[model samples]
Target chain A: MIDAHAMLGDETYLRLDADELLRRMDAAGVDLAVARPMGAGMVVDHRAGNDLVLKAGPRIRGLATVNPWWGPKALDELARCRDLGAVGLFLDPARQGFFPTEPVATPVLARAAEYGWPVMMKTGAYVYADILALAEVARDFPGTTFVAGFGGFADQWFELPMAMRNAPNLMLDASMMWGAGIQQIVDRHGAGRVLFGSAEPRNRYAVVLKAIERRGLDESSRRAVLHDNAARVFKLEGGRP
Target chain B: MRIIDFHAHLDERWLHKPIPDASHMVAAMDRLGVAQTCVYTMMGFYAETPRNNDLLLERSQRHPDRLIPFVTVDPKEGPAAVDELERCLERPEFRGIKFHPWLQAFAPSMLEETMVAILKVAARTDTPVLFHDGTPPYSTTFQIADLARWVPEAKVFLGHAGLADYVDPAARLLRDVPNLYGCYCGSRPGDLVHLIETAGADKITFGSDFDPGSWELLAERLDNTIEAGLSPEDLEAVLWRNAERTLRPSSR
Candidate 1:
């Protein structure tokens, strides 16, 4: 299964020497990993880690880390990532220190939509408000697909139903929080809108995988979530785990 | 093998909403082949009523053998927190106390003075303290680590030890600390196996933050762990024994 969300960009978040992390990914039963670095310098030192994942020979695909905080760097990384066979882009506002819809980010977001690249925004514990903001952005740009990582934190309990009702293109990944949140998201949004994501190495992927398996979802939906949805969203060719 | 899930959640999403009841939880457990579970109250900090606590206590009491309740309270509520702990401890259903410093917006270090007082009560009453750990840069691991050091006698459980790859720091905490027992509940199947191999499987607990993902992720983790060739005994220790050792007041 493809992990739709991963920070391959930032050196700080993931410094796993490429071969080692890839080995771990295999052990985790992850077939193809779609990842970007956490922040900007990951782009600078990109070759060091990128060389490792790139040589993964289809077992891994790299997402170029764009510094949304920097217009030039952000746009530059977009084209670079597209060329690198990256299927998606990972963005974190808390790390970027600016909201996704901020005027400065408009150029980057617009560029991503132009290239038909889906933007995965890291929602830092904001409940529904952050997801709602992403949905608004998606609505503004019809072609853009906004993947909200950590979608349903405690704060968003009331707003998720409404958020789902409003934003059809907004996708949620089940990576960070487990337990009731998974079922709630699946129930409200359906399996298609939900994709599987395990914040690797940081969070144990096995436990999250088991939670999904044991939650009693039907196999078709399970297969879709475990890899299919992410594959579709990211346009990845990785086989199932 | 009686698998014990050290991590699970009961939140507002499940409280007034269409949630898995004791039957639903048990059915899910049976599906997962889990024998017992230590369920934490994530929503309790936000809950305004004593009724929420009552509902949780009642729910746990209903399935005492299978589900062990970990009472959650907001220390910000001051005396009310103490009262709630007293109330929960009086009941046999709750195994011990559960604290979420990040959710409560209180640093674990700041709560120590009060936690020390509570730890004394916990030691007297023979209950342990359960703390959530997201590690560095998400939340301060040291906050919980500090609390753990201060109350050496009180067995402390730290959720998310293999925290997404905060493992270096989390691992250091696991190796360095004597009283702290960490539960691996983050993503990535290999991480758990790696930690299981690297840490000798003695310091970790298996936690599936299930019900969040339709159950596939958690099940995959457990299945992968078994596939990695852990002895049934080590598997039991990770999936049940360690948690049983940490959460059981009488075991201390």
Candidate 2:
């Protein structure tokens, strides 16, 4: 299975490099994982972490993250990151402390859409990255594939399933969500737009994987969420790099 | 060892599908080997606090052995809230109190007078109070910590243990607040592990946030607890012993 989200960086908070993430993937039965940069890279320096992800080897693909506050610098990083083979763009409003709908993010979002990179936003920060606000941004950039990471976790799903209907470009990852919630979303929206992500180190892969397995989804929806959806969204070939 | 889930809910509005009674909750508990589950009314979170509390009372009365009811109050009701809590405590079936500051849309910071009265009532009765914590502007771990400090005699639980991002703050607060404890409910396994490591295993009780039409939710929470890699003694504390102590403080 392809883990739709994870972080790889040698930062003080969660120092997970390629070997550690790959080791975790092997243990969790994950074939490939989309590795995004975390820590200082998420908020301050984007190039160092993006470089780390680019060199994390085949099993770990890179997701480029930049602080939307970085403005033109963020666009340059996106261009450099795309050329460096980063598979997608990750925007963390919580860490960077910006409302996702801020005009500053528009240029970054537009740049990513221009490259056809799926944009995954770290949600769950109330008004800053509220899922509804992300939905509005998704509507603004209809061509960009937007994955709402954690799907507005910590009690934001109350209206998100319905919100997905209005914005076709908006998708979700099953990280930090209850099993029943993920099941309800898939049942309501179908598994084509939902991807499996463990958010490991912050969350456990094995525990979340077990939660998904025991939910009793049909094999088709299960495969779509666990592998196929991520492959399609992140543009992985054969569920791997 | 018996497992007692300290947090579950009984409100059809949030259940998605129809559930005629508490049998589904009991059946799910039985299948998972959970001995008892403390149930609160989720509908009370949105509206009809007393009516939903009565509904929970009736449901708990039906399966006295398997379901433990926690009463809810719109503390904004002031004296009426205290009276309702006192009335509910008249029956031993109601073991604790549940509050959802975020969902109930009443921050304890804003309703200080009502909160003080309710906390005093819980303290006098030796009843544990569980707060749906981990959200901001209302139910952050620090905000709950203030309540715990306000009524140091009362047993206050951070119901979700700071959920996704607040676990660290919850753990930090647990270190300073003697009356404050955590429920291993909504926070992920890694956060739970950190809570256990930083605050000690004795500070937390296992909670599934389980409700009807969500049996798999219980299983997933159980997986989270087990995945935290607690030793048998620590697991026992989180799964049941800590909850038992909190439920019946006399036993402690």
What tens-digit string does per-residue lDDT give for candidate 1 at B77-151? 666777777876787677777776766677756665677767766776768676777634324556676677887
In candidate 1, how many Å is residue B250 off?
A: 3.3
A42-93 in candidate 1: lDDT tens per residue? 4344444444444555666765555566677668756766776766666666
**Deviation in angstroms for B111 in model 2?**
2.2
- lDDT per model vs. reference: 0.66, 0.85
Candidate 2 Cα lDDT to native: 0.85
Top-lDDT structure, candidate number: 2
True contacts kept of 1: 0.29
Model 2, span A1-241: residue lDDT tens: 9999887774433467788888899988899899888888777888887898888898888999888887788888888988888889998887788877898888888888888999999888687878988899999988889998988887787667977888988888888787777877888888898889988777789877888888888888889989998988888976531
Where model 2 places Cα greater than 4 Å from the true spot, the runs are: A10-15, B12-17, B249-252
